[model samples]
Target: MSASHPDNAPAATAASAQAFQTRLADRAAAMETTLTEIFNRRSAAPPRLLAAMRHAALGGGKRLRPFLTVETAALCGAEAATALPTAAAIELLHCYSLAHDDLPAMDDDDLRRGQPTVHKAFDEATAILAGDALLTLAFEVIADAGAHPSPDVRARLTLGLARAGGMTGMVGGQMLDLAAEGRWGAARLSPDDILHLQALKTGALLAFAVEAGGLVAGADADVQARLARYGKAVGGAFQIADDILDHEADAETLGKRAGKDAEKGKGTLVTALGLSGARAICDELIDGAIAALDCFGAEADMLRHAARFVGARRS
Candidate 1:
């Protein structure tokens, strides 16, 4: 079902959102170039490994998470360009997660981004190593130059990113998801339970993305709080939308296997609340996300658009 948001801006008003997507894609390509050059500088890094890393990371993605990092920083009066490395680092980590998630032990999918998954394109071992490399390199990129300006701030950024991306964070959420397969479904989760899972699994990194930029820009406590709230709401909305797409979108449009969640008996908002219910929850979450940005005044327009766009994203 096409969802309706309560905010004044029609979702279609986010026309500039598509331009942001293109800009993010271009920036991510440059990030890949830099990473490749750094790896090639060291002859010890195997060409095959490098190829696999690039294959997964440089593969097509919406780049929404990274763009959020950059734009959030910009909204706080910092130069968005200064946050490129941080943005790139987050994207690399995200790609790593996708690669591993598609492995035999995880989601066990064979396609990603309309092409062979990393494990399918190469060997399983190669795919594992590629994920490892990207995860490690993500830190290197973050520590390079674009960190929040102060050494303590930089350290905080590192810690936040690690927590958001590590086993205690996204991984923990994934484990819960895996465990919940065939058992919990969506009906079992209290709104609180749903919030708990999404906060860690989906919200944590997004919180980090927005907060990292704010931290870099030396945002005050109030700004950080607002961004964090916005991040959490959007993150939950994003997953809800994904859950909807899992049931509604076709594989060709989704760029990966659709209905995999249902096939695997995984719990999802739709599975819990049914289609209309999930869509309503998504709209509510989007409203909450946009509301969190009210403190930023008109400057937060992009963020408001982004929140709506997250709910509207197809993949």
Candidate 2:
């Protein structure tokens, strides 16, 4: 059959999507193994804290952030194994965020990844300590000699992740979200305001995934910049998709509470723009994400697929 035949297009598209999913699953599984190894090596921590950390991080989830790190590094010509430490570091930080986010003082959710949240599974203080330990452990993983051969690279990765996880990024965004909920002061946020909040909260760490990948690969400035742009675009699209899911999906499907955004009066793109408008913006971000990858060749197709996947995902 002709490769260009119209009859083959649908089959080709399906095959491509399947291939992307397979690759995503493979990377996700690899990241799970990496996390396992990390825990195995650090077994001397307090038993309760270790149990809470393992419970909070180990069970299930897509592991999207780590996959991004591995893939971005591969695109820059680094091996998957070489990216594992940095990737694991990012996942540790993400798990820490989730543990803390579900604390009584925060979102107070009872479930995560379809299981009891850390606080519920353990105790409030243990959960807090677990979160704290996981957060510090992220830097520990990234700073290891395994992450990179050079001190310069290690330092950059450490500094970059710190900024991404700190007040200038995710923490700052969380503060703004609380204000949206009237914890400090309530105010109606415009679309731009929502974007800013999401950019800081959700997008910063995501963007750093690729930035870390580039740093790991020792890619030049132009490549790093392009990866950063793609990461930011995908981060924006991912958050919008998440907001849409909260509006439409149930808790069972989301593996966590659905519609908490509404309950907390959190401002989102979906709230600022209507659902249809939010979808439009999501598509635009996906377009921008793909465009950012034009500098790379076929090696970046997986990334392009990731952007499309972000826009169309249901949960």
Candidate 3:
């Protein structure tokens, strides 16, 4: 890593990658533990539904959304522990979305995170209920006193999540996506339309994730704005990266059906702009995301690293 030894530049890069992965894994583990405890306190609920809920929420993945929340909170001078409840809440909401998205009426996916999806493992009704329960419990987690001592913080986080996942957010985007696909005699979407849908469907939650930390830390408006911008760019990059992977990666590598977007006639950045153009947009988003954090110093390095890592997702 010594600058004097330029010959080891590649080695240094590899070391840095390893360290970032290690850091990511550590944060993911912490979030997993919180989720485990939350799911464990449901003895009164029906056993099967609880199991299905657990299956949906506890399934293995990168846990990136919650990781961003915790990391952004840390960068804004909040303790990771203090931010964990909100982080876990966001993760639960994310899992709920995935579960519903994989339903026959939605994305109709059979696999998730390399495992049989909730509907396939259980039943469609169970999967639906699990997703519903997870979504409802997410609010409960965020509203709980444990999420933040200040009632105002909890309220703001709750409202933010509602707006992100509600009619004007993910739900609206899903509707737009279906319409764009001509499911009900809808028209074809232009590139701008696709971008707007993506911002609502995918970017909203991520924007909330990055901003959640600041809310937890009581960060000023300017810091919150920076995190919001960073989160938005990162979310854009993630979707584009995923679009590229869907075309390039196989089922085994992607943990789900590949090229489903194309098969379903979905309009994506890739479909609209082609592979090279989509990648260029992704690169620009990553650069902008990193630039958004320049207001901070070395403390924001992990976030900058995260922007690249998220964009780099592939087979």
Better candidate number, 1 or 3, judged by lDDT:
3
Of 1 and 3, the candidate ranking higher by TM-score = 3
Better of 1 and 2 by TM-score: 2
How far is 191's C-alpha from truth in model 1 (Å)? 4.9
**What are the root-mean-square deviations of the candidates from the true structure over C-alphas?**
2.9, 3.6, 3.6
| Residue range with the least summed lDDT across 10 consecutive positions in model 1 | 1-10
Model 3: per-residue Cα lDDT at residue 93: 92
Off by over 4 Å in 2: 1-12
lDDT tens per residue, model 1, 27-81: 5576566555656665577989989988897747777777788788889888877
Give the TM-scores of the predictions, in the order they appear. Answer: 0.90, 0.95, 0.95
lDDT of 1 at 154: 73
Tell me the tens digit of each residue's lDDT in model 2 across 181-224.
Answer: 88876588999999999998999999999799889999999998
- After superposition, the stretches of candidate 3 with alpha carbons farther than 4 Å from their true spots are 1-12
Per-candidate Cα lDDT values, in order, are 0.80, 0.88, 0.87
